[model samples]
Target: MAPDYTLDRNDELLIAVSLFEYSREWEIAEPWNAERAWFLCRVICERHGLSPSEAVLELE
Candidate 1:
């Protein structure tokens, strides 16, 4: 089922910034750290009731 809850502006901004940092780390960090960053990004999306794709759409 879809989540009924919605993020407020501050939460959205926080998530967006976190996502961006995670993505950056995924690109530039060592392989192990990159993997960790990727995992964290997924966790963040899941915790917020979003799929990675959905999170991207929300950022747009």
Candidate 2:
């Protein structure tokens, strides 16, 4: 099933920034999209058994 959370532009940017800091792969890419950030967020949430909001908090 898909995640129950919806991220706004600020949340998407926050996720993108976190991804950039946490992953060299994303760093090399530089610019990140909401789609990619959302996908990554879902992956993280699923891997850690967290909700999307919790994942963002944890990432922060």
Candidate 3:
């Protein structure tokens, strides 16, 4: 069995911001970083109910 968990609004926003930063850094990082970043981004998006495209959207 697994413990249940949920993200409050703040946590979700923080993760989204971090994901955005990781994406920006990915551009300047080594080519190999793209794979790792992509995987992490996908997992984050899935867990947070966010789409890959929406990950880059500006939060209001």
Candidate 1 TM-score to native: 0.53
Order of the predicted models by TM-score, top scorer first: 1, 3, 2
- Top candidate when judged by TM-score against the true structure: 1
Per-prediction count of colliding residue pairs? 0, 0, 0
Local lDDT at 15 for model 3: 72
Q: By lDDT, who's the top model here? A: 1
TM-score of each: 0.53, 0.38, 0.47
TM-score of 2: 0.38
Reference-based lDDT, residue 38, model 3: 64
Q: Tell me model 2's lDDT, rounded to 2 decimals.
A: 0.58
What lDDT would each prediction earn against the true structure?
Answer: 0.68, 0.58, 0.65
lDDT per residue (tens digit) for residues 1-60 in model 1: 987998785476467557656666667656666666667767777777876677777766
Residue 42, model 1: Cα distance from true site in angstroms? 0.9
> Which candidate model has the greater TM-score, 1 or 3?
1
Error of 2 at 51 (Å): 1.0
